[model samples]
Target: MSDLSRLSLNQATIKYAGMEQAVSACLRAEIPGIGLWREPVAEYGLRKTGALLRQAGLTPTSMCRGGFFTSPDSDQRIKDLADNRAAVDECAELGVPELVLVSGGLPDGSRDVDGARSMVLDSLAELAPYAGERGVRLAIEPLHPMFCSDRCVVATLGQALDLASRFPAEQVGVVVDTYHIWWDPTVYQAIERAEGRISAFQVCDWITPLPAGVLLGRGMMGDGCIELRRMREAVDKAGYTGPIEVEIFNQEIWDADAMEIAELTAARYVEHVL
Candidate 1:
């Protein structure tokens, strides 16, 4: 089995860094895989971003996101689909393995989580084929239940696996991020059930006593209560031998030097997860 030493850096950890700057930091630290966000790509231009990453010999792990299937109006839904199509093209251009899908939450003026989930699946059913033709696997990343209202509706590993089961193994997968799923009662068994459908495994510690209306305050590994070693074991047991990507969205980390943050994140993941 491969050790958990191969940790990838998700750019959100250092959101203050520009595209070229982040790529340079990862390259300097010899990190192998990176996850890119759309805003930075738009700011730096897709062709330039891809060329620079290639020059630096970095692998684009997965696009930051491309799923928001819970909008009330058909107009918004069409817009989201268009935006997702553009994201898919970017992934194909960068040769990224998967497009992380954080299926969106309840629609406006509605409280129907199930209906929103249905919308997500329906969108995936349509988009997966197009993405497959481009050699980009769609990875469903189930957000924590705390985000069930506005961020993502799929809130468990089993829920994600069930969605993936609707498609072929190669066409669809899931991102098992510890921060979002650690509280799940069935996480271990669900990972076992995930089998080969686990495409990306992200790590981050979840902080408690969150301030009101604060959506993102992820702590670094070992800073919060998440059992990093156990989460790694679950993914490994499920036969997912991919690089464990560290995705911390902390405001404090963002204010630090990009290189230092990347190095510290790598060290922490290795320290706690191995």
Candidate 2:
């Protein structure tokens, strides 16, 4: 088991578990890392969550999210900026290294993909300094193209690398997730370009023949066709030795016990990828 200690379980993998219970599972599984979501932290209270992680001796690989930078309404844009600033504060408070960002999709009534992307770039330019000042690197996660219209504007590793190039290495970077970007043709090349700027690496298997409007269909490792070992090799080659965070969001997994999910994920990584 090549030190499954480096495996982190993103809390969404066990959404049925309470924040504290999830911590218990991670601790029991000997997982050294975790990735928390803003809502769960808010629900459990950030200070309390941080204390829980500390008690469990777990460090967060990165916060689950903090970037929804595209909106048609100027007011909404300002709101997103304010929200991300608060996210930065939360990440700093927890002593986490990175804030994962899912640059949001096009504004209402707008289909101009380029314009939406520009908005995301401008928003990051404005927010990166704040995050940097607080010692939090913003990790721009490129969602799958399936989410291009409604969930995220950034949809490829190549595009995310391009976005990171606009900011300082300490301030901005890319997060590679097999579930979201494995199908990208230039994925491996993009990872090489990422190099030191690969702020985070997430894992989740991909299931084909997805249904319409499906927002949470992430499969577990070895349960789907994703070549996680190859992806991990790519990440290691890209110079990122960070935790491989399992971030499954499937209904079946989310409804199961947290400890079971964490254990299974860790075992799979050790057996197939490590």
Candidate 3:
């Protein structure tokens, strides 16, 4: 078996599990790392979650998201900024150095993707320093273009890198997720450019016949068309030697037992991504 030391199971891969169950599954699989999201962590209580991970000998490889920065309403924008700062604080408290960001899509009915992207950059400008001060790095995750209207406006690794470039490497970085980035022609080049700023690497695959609600379309690695191993190599070549998180979003997978899902992810990671 390939060394499983660096395989981090992203919490969403077993989305139905409670925090305790997620940590337990990671331990059972001999997975050394996990990618945690704020909602479940919040629901479980941070101190308790921390204790559990510490007890299980699992490191939190990354914090799953702290952005939605494209709000047009002044009041909402203020709230968003404050929430980002809070996110930074949470990462610091939990000792997670990387805080992943999914830049929100166009504010309701707005056609200006350019405008939405600009807002992402602006939000980064404000968020980077705060995160940096707390020893937390903002890792921008560019979603696939299909999500540009409602999920994330940052649709290409190049665009994410462009915004991240405006800040110091320590303050801002980018994520390399195979499921979302595999289709980009310039993906390899972008990975090379990310270099020292590549914060986290997440793995999943893209399959056809996406579910009507597309948010859950991500396939488990090796079950779809993504060049999972190639992407892992590129990120490694770019100097990202951190955790490779398994982050599938299929409801079918979620409906399975968490332990089974975790074991399956580890097996697929070794077979398809190692």
Candidate 4:
């Protein structure tokens, strides 16, 4: 299985499974790691989630998100920053070190991409020290350009790195998700530039004929066109030796048997990512 030791099944990959069920699936597959999300963690109870992962011997890789820092309203910005601080506290309690961030897109009726990006930077400047104090790193994850309008504004790895470079590497970093950046022509160079800033290395394929709500269109490791292994090698070459999370978001996979999906994910990861 090409050493499934470093493989992590992100909870979103099996969206139907609750936290306990997800842990059980990981155990059955002998997967050593798991990437947790905030909602499920809250549902399971933070202290209880920590206890369960510790008991099950599964490592908490990274948290799903802690951003949305593109608000133009000062009140909304305050709320977002508070929520992020809580997210950082949650990560510290759960023993997860990386908190992935998706920079929010334009505010209502606003089209200034440059201005939205500036808001992201300013918000990060406010949260970075708070996160660093809690021993958590804010990993800026630039979504694909398709998501630039609503979900994220940082569209490239270089751009994500530019934002990360503004803060201490221990405080702010970047997530290199294969499905999002594999199509970028200068991805390798960006990875090189991201040496110390690569906080998380996520893997998932990009499927064709994207489903509605494109957020759920991610494919299994070998099911699409992304060069999973090359991306892995590039991240490795950049010195990020952390858990490789399989964070796919697809309705079909979510509807399948959780354990079987996990097994298939592991096998495909071995075949395609390693």
**lDDT scores of the candidates, listed in order:** 0.86, 0.88, 0.92, 0.93
Clashing pairs in 2: none
Q: Per-residue alpha-carbon lDDT of model 1 for 155-191, expressed as tens digits?
A: 9989999899999888899989998889888889999
Clashes of 4: 0
Worst 10 residues of 4 by lDDT: 1-10
Flag regions of model 1 displaced more than 4 Å: 1-5
Model 2 alpha-carbon miss at residue 131, Å: 0.6
Ranking by lDDT: 4, 3, 2, 1
**Candidate 2 local Cα displacement, residue 83, angstroms:** 0.5
Per-residue lDDT, model 4, residue 55, is 98
Better-scoring candidate (TM-score), 1 or 4? 4
Q: Report lDDT (Cα) of residue 196, candidate 2.
A: 93
Question: 129 in model 2: Cα distance from truth in Å?
Answer: 0.9
TM-score of each: 0.95, 0.97, 0.98, 0.98
- TM-score-wise, the better of 2 and 4 is 4
lDDT tens readout by residue for model 3, 1-274:
6799899999999999999899899998889999999999999998888888888889999998899999999899999999999888988888998999999999888999999998888889888988999999999999999999998999999999999999999999999998888999999999999999999999999988899879899998888998899899999999889999999888899999999989998898889999
Give model 2's TM-score versus the native structure.
0.97
Best by lDDT: 4
Q: Write out the backbone clash pairs for model 4.
A: none
